[model samples]
Target: MINRFLQNGLQGKYAHYQTDMLFNGLNWEMAGERPEGSHHSVWELLFHMNYWQDFILAELQEENPESPKDPSDSWPGSPFPSSEKEYTEMVTQFLKGLGRATQQASKDSLEESLGGRKRTPADMLMVLINHNSYHAGQVVYARRLIGAWPPPDGDESDE
Candidate 1:
């Protein structure tokens, strides 16, 4: 039951918009544009989310990945993709990471600790879900600010 709930949260099933829905139909140009007063562009926000997602996944897999010495290291690179292809690749990678996390959540013992760390898989998964959810809202706000909301497929109501 816990695993099921974790998996659902990883997919943003009930708490908010699905990751794929929020990201679909975005072009590089639109992604690169930062709405007024926004701290980051859509591409930047996605990149930031992907950064932590990868980190959490590594820890879940017991990779013992090193924490970035500087907070900014997690948000490295340009605020936007360099081209259409780059943007597409970012989106693909982000979604793939989400899929990986969802798979991890299906494990029988989400409470099992990894690498002698006090944190369990469930702990990491919750962090990932919460982090992604926070940034997901930012992505939506950025899209709306730039007039890119209601992606080509339509809004959550259509779901």
Candidate 2:
């Protein structure tokens, strides 16, 4: 079930704005940069976000019988996607898989641990959100550094 709290909370707008921020002036190079010592690029960030969304859904299904058990999975390696089309497709597929999981998840199922110390489906979801936000920030900052980022939508500035 779609969490009414999330739908009503800032999370809804936060996720949407983040997506918009990433796509505003994106290009192949901007999406595929590793940038010196950093381990991920914009493309990698997107891939990672989609990947863990699937992972959380998979973990959630260890107890619940209704979740999709698809074997194809999201992606296989670091920076695997080369083109914008492929990168977009991977994220799209990941979101579709997440949609299936969200449809199947129950509040009780989300709270149950899948074993280990204290991992639960809700924990898994939280991890994905946190990770995505981290990488999304990096992507936006990188875009600015690379001179790819466009101006802010409104008059507001970080300063």
Top-lDDT candidate index: 1
Distance (Å) between predicted and true CA of 71, model 2?
A: 21
Q: What does candidate 2's lDDT look like per residue over 8-89, in tens digits?
A: 2213243433343344446655667666655666677676666666666666666433433554334345553566788677
The per-model lDDT (C-alpha) reads: 0.86, 0.55
Clashing pairs in 1: none
The TM-score of predicted model 2 comes to 0.60
Over 4 Å off in model 1, which ranges?
Answer: 156-159
- Give the clash count for each candidate: 0, 0
Residue 109 shift from truth in candidate 2, angstroms: 4.8
TM-score of each: 0.94, 0.60
Candidate 1 achieves a global lDDT of 0.86
